[model samples]
Target: MHALVVDSDAAESSFLSAELQRHGFDAQECVTGAEALEIHDKFDLLLLDLRLPDIDGLEVCRAVRATSDIPLIAFAAGDHGLDRVLCLQAGADDCLAKPYGLRELIARIEAVLRRSGPARTAPRPATDPLARGSLCIDPLTREVRLNGRLVHLTRKEFDLLHRLAADPHTVHSRARLMTDLWGYPAGYVPDARASRTIDTHVSALRAKLGAPDWVLTVRGVGFRFGRA
Candidate 1:
């Protein structure tokens, strides 16, 4: 991994850069925000100091974020809560307070690098519309049409359709549906009232599609998409 260390303190940058190199990183050192801005794109990871003589560190973070999704670890004033929050809001992947341990810093860098994998940098693949006879559902655009007529469905209704349709052969349980579509926490046992919410939406979805079998209730379990 390539790492760029930017700090006003020459010794600090040199030490950090050298340590990163020792840990299998191709590291580069720079003293000012301008230097960092000019050549940051070439590097895969950035170790930025939030205090610089020429430019505000937050501005540098914002500038870099606008163009690239490079993994960034900003060294900010740790005691100040606002400073840390601002660093994150300005687009730093993670922030660390100074007087930190080298071991911890290295771990954080590796963690960030792992998270910002090649998949994240690549463009999203195009998703083809899910077509079933007279009905068409577009996952990318979240639009649904039945018999060539645009069917206006509420967000929840559409989500239910797509989820069940995506795996039409499989039965999706009520608890599982609640957790996946409604953002319910894991291991949550839905009560009768919560269970009714899903049933209500499914009924509305079936009505909108003009067919009850599109979403078939599997008796005691939950619902599934029926091709017919």
Candidate 2:
């Protein structure tokens, strides 16, 4: 895999590039945000640092996202919560705080790439709606119907439900859900805040569906689509 490393710090960039190369990535290094934008299409993924010479990294993230859905990881030094959220909101696929371990960085990279990569198993066709008993979800139209009645949900709520219903038997952890839905890596957001966010959304979803058991909580674990 080819990865573009965007950082103004020479030593940091060199370390990241070398490490990525050791892990089988063809790493390309660029020192400025402008350079990154100019060569973004040449790589399979992006490793961006928030501090840059010409333009801010968040701007770079927005620019790249406006054009392509390339896998992006923002590695920056700042308050973990705020920086992580900002990076995600700006369109990065993952955000890692500075002074992060190389192993963790690699793991995050692999995880993001895995999610962005094509599925290994054949997925349900996009045009086909997903149905489980009284619940129905149309991915193409982003529509959900419960018991033959239309249900209104925000984007995040719809996405959360779709993920759970997609794998009804799997137990999704709160951390996993946060990463999948919010783009923040597991543990990046405080446990309490993340759990609350998920719970609030689940509650809204349950109320809208008028079926409290539609989504079952795994207690301390996470949530799943219950069998009707």
Best by TM-score: 2
| Model 1 residue 119 CA deviation in Å | 6.9
For all predictions, the C-alpha RMSD in Å is 12.2, 9.1
**Candidate 1 vs. true structure, TM-score:** 0.54
Q: What lDDT does model 2 reach? A: 0.82
- Per-residue CA lDDT of model 1 for 165-202, tens digit only, reads 87789898988776666556556688864676677678
Clashing pairs in 1: none
lDDT of model 2 at position 119: 41
User: Where is model 2 more than 4 Å wrong at Cα?
Assistant: 123-228
Q: Which ten residues in a row have the lowest lDDT in candidate 2?
A: 117-126
N/CA/C clash count, model 1: 0
Q: Please write out the lDDT profile of model 2 over residues 1-228, one tens digit for every residue.
A: 999999999999999999999999999899999999999977899999999989988999988875555789998795579888888878787898888999999999988877664344424435678989978999899899878888877666887888888888999888777766756644554366456657767887888888788899998778888873
How does candidate 2 fare on TM-score? 0.55
**TM-score, per-candidate, Cα-based:** 0.54, 0.55
